[model samples]
Target: MKRIGAFLLTGAFLLMNVAVMAQCSLCTKTAQQLGEGPAKGLNNGILMLALTPLVIIGFLAFRWWKSNKEA
Candidate 1:
């Protein structure tokens, strides 16, 4: 039951999407002026930046879970 609850919670978190406007006015203006290539690069950079902390936290959580399971 605890495992099922945890799975549902994690699934809900993974599926939830929040619309966030992370760009400042200057950045938006620059991207608009730079054409498609630069705009794509900027977007990829933003995604990498955004995902880095989540990836780190997920890794740490996985490690903690493994350790707890062994005990």
Candidate 2:
């Protein structure tokens, strides 16, 4: 039951997509003026930044699970 609940919670979080408003008006304006290349780079950078913490958490969770399973 606990595993099922955790699976559902994780699935919900993964499926959720919230619209993120631009944080800096000046930066946004500059990116737009610079054209598609800079805009794409900015988007990729944001995604990489956002994924870093999730990746760390996931690795820690996997380690914890493995340790608990062994014991």
TM-score of candidate 1 versus the correct structure, residues matched by position: 0.57
Give the best candidate by lDDT. Answer: 1
Q: Model 1, 54: alpha-carbon shift in Å? A: 1.7
Best by TM-score: 1
lDDT of candidate 1 at residue 70, scale 0 to 100: 100
Cα lDDT of candidate 2 equals 0.81
Please provide TM-scores, in order, for all candidate models, with all chains considered together: 0.57, 0.54
What stretches of model 1 exceed 4 Å from their correct place?
1-25
Rate residue 38 of model 2 by lDDT. 84
Clashes of each: 0, 0
User: For each candidate, what is the lDDT?
Assistant: 0.84, 0.81
